[model samples]
Target chain A: AQRVTQPEKLLSVFKGAPVELKCNYSYSGSPELFWYVQYSRQRLQLLLRHISRESIKGFTADLNKGETSFHLKKPFAQEEDSAMYYCALFNDYKLSFGAGTTVTVRA
Target chain B: NAGVTQTPKFRVLKTGQSMTLLCAQDMNHEYMYWYRQDPGMGLRLIHYSVGEGTTAKGEVPDGYNVSRLKKQNFLLGLESAAPSQTSVYFCASSSPGTSKNNEQFFGPGTRLTVL
Candidate 1:
């Protein structure tokens, strides 16, 4: 079985400040990691995928195979970034998701 | 195109009652999934289908039953509604078996309440 964990339930930061949401996973085989974000009243959407190795909306995540972590980071926070984020792992044909982290970027 | 649409955006059901949630995707993707979202539990897969007429159990499929009679439709049924089953349900689809990365597109979601 595979599991994903998002340690922080809520993370708050001021505008222009850096923010990081921690995620860790436990899988026996190779893993594919992804970050998903859901804004207020909006449907959940993909933020970034580790395979792409590209940043979206100034957010990036590095897959640390050694540590089994894929943490999402943004250099500067914006009020519009406040929303719920989820970390997920794809194994075989199923995707396992973390509990999710809510980010609040205050002005 | 309407990416993925779930019928009955919002529903209220009483305990012991039964209801079925319908999910349709226009992308003609081969893979479809049903998931439930709660406050802190994120999204838990309730059931999934790889192709038409085939259904498989997912992470949380105990109280749920599913059917995939058509290639673009997946239905989730609750035999006896329970308060614990009240949550937001989301339908997602991906063009798997062809795409390597397999990015899933989700629907707006259906909020189900059991009283």
Candidate 2:
């Protein structure tokens, strides 16, 4: 079975501080990892995908096959970055999501 | 384009009552999905459709039913509502392949409460 686990239920950081949200997965095959974000009053949307190897909104996540980890990181937190983040693994044409981490960037 | 839209942005139902949530996508995607979001649970797939007239059960399809009679719309039905069913429902659509990164475009979500 494919499973995604996000260790932190909530994370808080002061503005301009670096933040990292941990994600780990259990899957036998090569994993396709992605980070989805949902802001207040907004719909859930893709923030970044490991295959893209790109950053969005100052956030980036590197897929580590050895550790089976895909942690999201940002150099500096911003108030606008506060939202619910979900780490998902895609397999068999479906996505298995983590419990999610709520990020709060305090000004 | 409306992208993806779900009917009844908010709904309240009593236990044992039945209701249906409708989702429509104008992006002409071949895949549609229904999911429920709850605190600490993130989002769980309730059901999905690969194309018109084809529906499949997902991770948490126990109490929910889905139909894809039309290519552009997918409907989720609950035979009997329960308090545990209270959660925000989301509808999403995506293309079949990885050309679009398999990104699912989501609706604003339907907030359902069963009291």
Candidate 3:
């Protein structure tokens, strides 16, 4: 079975401060990781994927195979960044998601 | 394009009742999925379809049934609703080997409450 864990359920950070959301996965083989964001009551949107190696909305995540982790980070937090974020792992044409972290960026 | 769309933005059901959720995508994606979002558990896949007329069970499929009769549509059915079955259902679609990088496009979600 594949599993994704997001240890922190809630994360609060002040504007302009650096914020990081930790994600860890348990999979025996090479893995594909993705970060998805849900803003307020809106639909979930793709933030970024490990294979893309690109940053979206000033946020970036690096996949660490040694640690089996994919942590999302941003240098400066904006109020607009407040949302629910989920880390997902793809295996056999299916995506397994973490419990998710709710970020609150206070001004 | 509308991307993905789901019917019944919100619903309330009684125990033992039955209902079906409709999902439609305009992106011509080859894969469509149904997932239920619960508090603290994130999103769990209920069922998925890789192509028209092909359906498969996902991680949590015990209480749900799915059909992919058409290429652009997928339907999820709950034969007998239970209190524990209440959740926000989300529909997503993705097409591989495209510029999308297999990114799934999601619907707004359907919030269901069982009484």
Candidate 4:
């Protein structure tokens, strides 16, 4: 079975402050990880993937095989960054998502 | 493209009532999925289809049924709705291949409440 854990249900940060959303995973093989985000009144959308190693909205995540973790981070939090974030693992043509973390960027 | 569209943005069903939720994707994605999101819980897969005419159960498939009669459409059914079944349902679709990295496109979601 594949599992994704976000550990934190909510994270509050001041504008311009750094933000980190913790995520951990359990899988037997080489894994694929992704971060998905859902803004208020919007549908869920992909934030970034470990494979692409690309940053979206100033956020990035590095897949750490040794630690079995893929934590999302951003140097500066923006009010627009407030949304629900989910860590997901792909296996057997399906995605296993974490419970999710709701970020609140207070001004 | 419309991406993915789900019918009946909101619904209320009585206990023991039956209903079907429809999802359609115009992206020509080969894979489609159904998931339910409960309060304070992650989205749990209920059923999925890799292609038309094929359906497979997911982690929480005990109380749901699914069919993919058309490549562009997938339907989820509830033979008997229960209060516990009240939640938001989301449908997603993706095409496989290409470095094994394709993000699923999600619908707006359907809010269901069972009394």
DockQ: which candidate is best?
Answer: 3
What are the per-residue Cα lDDT tens digits for candidate 3 across A53-101?
A: 9999999999999999999999999999999999999887788999999
- Kindly report which residue stretches of model 1 are placed more than 4 angstroms away from their true locations once superposed: B97-100
TM-score on alpha carbons, each prediction: 0.98, 0.98, 0.99, 0.98
Docking class of 1: high
| Sliding window of 10 residues with minimal summed lDDT for model 2 chain B | B95-104
Give the per-residue lDDT of model 3 (tens digit) for B47-88. 999899999999899979999999999999999999999999
- Give interface RMSD, every candidate, in order: 0.6, 0.7, 0.6, 0.8
Candidate 2: tens digits of C-alpha lDDT, residues B1-115: 8899999999999999999999999988999999999999989999999899999999999999999999999999999999999999999999965678578899999999999
- Angstrom error of the Cα, residue B57, model 2: value is 0.8
Q: Can you write out model 2's per-residue Cα lDDT over A7-36, one digit (the tens) per residue?
A: 999999999999999999999998989999
Off by over 4 Å in 4: none
Candidate 2's C-alpha runs over 4 A off are none
Q: For model 3, which pairs clash? A: none
Q: In DockQ, how does model 3 score against the reference complex?
A: 0.87
State the lDDT at B59 in candidate 1.
86
| DockQ for candidate 4 | 0.82
**Which of the numbered candidates is closest to the native, going by highest lDDT?**
3
How would the docking of model 4 be graded? high
Q: What is the lDDT of residue B91 in candidate 4?
A: 99
CA shift of A55, model 1, Å:
0.7
For model 3, the chain A TM-score is 0.98
For model 4, residues B59-90, the per-residue Cα lDDT tens digits are 99988999999999999999999999999999
